[model samples]
Target: MTLLICAFAAIIATVKWYKDAPEGNMKLGILCWMYWGASIMWLVDAIFEYAELKAEYFTPAPADMLNDAFLGLAVVALGLIIWLVWLLIKDPRGVVKAALIRKKA
Candidate 1:
């Protein structure tokens, strides 16, 4: 579940990054990298767990499934939060700088 969720996010971010490639913005690319890395990590985790659980891995408890889903969502949200903080610090479009200048007036 975590692998699937992060893979989807990575795919979406990759597409968006490709679309905006000419603009040279780094944020989308950063997001893509983060999600893809997470997906790969989770894929490895899944593989190891599957090896340990064998056939039983296919039949997770409902509670476990729900918990995995929540964890996946939380990971996605945290990635977004990290991206947002990076964006704010970078201020790529200078919105924050402009706002501060305006405030000085």
Candidate 2:
């Protein structure tokens, strides 16, 4: 299940990178941020589940732990996806400018 989640994430990251490659570095940066955010979320959830299993005398059922981890990751991923979509809506051009361009001539 973890592997499947990771694989889907990898595909999203790849597509985002490829989309940004030709246009602007900002898209790449945002996509990378989104990817890392997702990865970190899952990593933290896994650690927590690991600790939970270790602390209990009875090991958590595989299905239970897996469900918890999947739930946590899905929540985090959903938040990030929403934010990414918001960013896209806000910046339809997909460019991040350090400074606004002005007509001097």
Candidate 3:
């Protein structure tokens, strides 16, 4: 479930990054990297668990599945938060700077 969720996010982020390739001002590339990295990590974890559990690996308990879903959502949310913080700090279009200057005036 974790792998599935992350792979979806990675795909979506990658596509968005490609579409925005010309301008490249949103710092979306960072988001793509983060999602891909998470997907790879989950893939590796699934592989090791499968090797250990063999046939039983497919049958996860209901509670475990729920936990994995929550964790995946949390990870996606964290990635977005980080990206937003980066965008605010960079102020690529000078929006934040302009707002601050206006407030001072």
Candidate 4:
């Protein structure tokens, strides 16, 4: 479940990044990299767990699935938060700079 969610997020971010490939302003590429990295990490984890659990891996408990879902959501939310903080620090549109200047006026 976590793998599925992360894979979906990575695909969406990749597509969005491709669409705005010409524009380098928002730094969306970084977000794409983060999500893709997470997806790959989860994929590796799934593979190792499957190897250990074999066929039983297919049938996880409902509670476990719920927990995985929550974790996936949390992971996605954390990625977004990090991206937002980075964007604010970068201030691609100069909004932060303008606000600071206004405060000085």
Candidate 5:
């Protein structure tokens, strides 16, 4: 479930980044890398768990499935939050700088 969620996010981010390739924004690329890395991590986790559980891995308990879904959503939200903070710090478009300068007047 985590792999699925992160893969989806990575795909979306990659597409968005590609569309804005001319802008050469680092934030978008970072977001894509983060999600893709997470997806790969989850994939490896899933593989090892599958090896341990064998056939049983296919039938996860409903509660476990729900928990995994919530965890996946939380991770995605956290990634977005981190990206927002980075964007604010970078102030790529200078909105924050402009606001601060205006306040000095």
Candidate 6:
């Protein structure tokens, strides 16, 4: 089924991101994985929406599909919040600070 294909695609994409993420930026790698998961979720949701639209032109009940999309967005938002909160609370000496310090004149 299409959903199965989508699931496989998502898993492959996530693995690819994990492999390709920059070595020095672990935070960035986590963020990338979060975003990649979200993107794949939305991509699957879009495919569902398109299929529903084509099958039933007048009434495309895409609520389930939209829910998946929102779930993806929520996951990404939650991951970002966790990362930012960690920076504020745990890792005060963040990577951004070092980058900024280097750029200072």
The best candidate in terms of TM-score: 3
Kindly list the per-residue Cα lDDT of model 3 for residues 1-105, writing each as its tens digit.
878888898899999999988887998988999999989988999999999999888999999999998988888899999999999999999999998886634
Best by lDDT: 3
The stretch of ten residues in a row with the least summed lDDT in candidate 6 is: 1-10
lDDT, residue 82, model 4:
93
TM-score of 4: 0.91
User: 2 or 5, which is superior by lDDT?
Assistant: 5
Tens-digit lDDT track of model 2 for 1-105:
453465466567667777767765434455455656666676787678667776562465798768956875775477468657766556656353323555477
Candidate 1 error regions (>4 Å): 24-26, 103-105
Error of 1 at 85 (Å): 0.5
Q: Residue 53 CA error for candidate 5 (Å)?
A: 1.3
**Tens digits of lDDT, candidate 5, 6-50:** 889999999999998978655787799899999998899999999
Off by over 4 Å in 4: 103-105
lDDT of all predictions: 0.88, 0.61, 0.90, 0.89, 0.88, 0.56
Please give each candidate's TM-score: 0.91, 0.44, 0.92, 0.91, 0.91, 0.40
Q: In lDDT terms, how accurate is model 1? A: 0.88
> For residues 1-105, what per-residue lDDT tens digits would candidate 6 score against the true structure?
233343444465457656866553334445556555656675677678777777564343588556655655565457667666665554544755666567647
How much does candidate 6 score in TM-score?
Answer: 0.40
Write down the lDDT that model 6 would get.
Answer: 0.56
The alpha-carbon deviation from the true structure for residue 13 of candidate 4, after best TM-score superposition, in angstroms, is: 0.8
Clashing pairs in 6: none
